[model samples]
Target: MSDPNPSPEAFRQMASEYIEVANRQGQDAYVGAVATAMLHAGARYAAFVAASNSPNKTQMQLSRKTNLDQITAQFRTYLEGHYDEHSENYDSYIKR
Candidate 1:
């Protein structure tokens, strides 16, 4: 089965939800899941933008390895920034 294609906002919400879960549960597994969700959302959005920019009307490859790698890196950096913010407010989340 194919994964549901989720919007950027969907991913953001997922990340937030998972982070809260992680804090509440105090589980490393939930932390990983949250990060994965954030990265996937970022990558999906990047791929959508890349495909929209293509001029070809015919069937074309939507993703190349290098391009995806670059996109993932950018997304990782963006996710890390959010993670930092979450970490800062982690105590509040845990208290919930």
Candidate 2:
């Protein structure tokens, strides 16, 4: 079976690719709008994955709350870490 837990490097590379796409969109797009679009895309893809893994619609519905909670918690943790890092270097980040 494949590893249950993937490496941080794998995640970093995926994140970098996402960021690169956002960067390539150019200054014509508002950063907040782009971020919102990415968030929506993530949510839609997550729902698709959950549905795909379930044997039936009822099973997917039954697990929806659990899946949502897990995803929300993971997002919170990631957001907190990034928030703390930015807070630590607020001056430098703001200047960028």
Per-candidate TM-scores read: 0.43, 0.86
Model 1: runs farther than 4 Å from truth?
1-44, 57-63
Query: For model 2, which pairs clash?
Result: none
Over the stretch 1-96, how does candidate 1's per-residue lDDT look in tens digits?
534687889888987885586566545456667656755766688778777765663432644666678777886897799799989999985666
List candidate 2 stretches off by more than 4 Å: 1-4
Full-model lDDT for every candidate: 0.69, 0.88
Residue 84 deviation, candidate 2, in Å? 1.1
Positional deviation of residue 18's Cα in model 2 after best superposition, in angstroms: 0.3
Candidate 1 local distance difference test against the native: 0.69
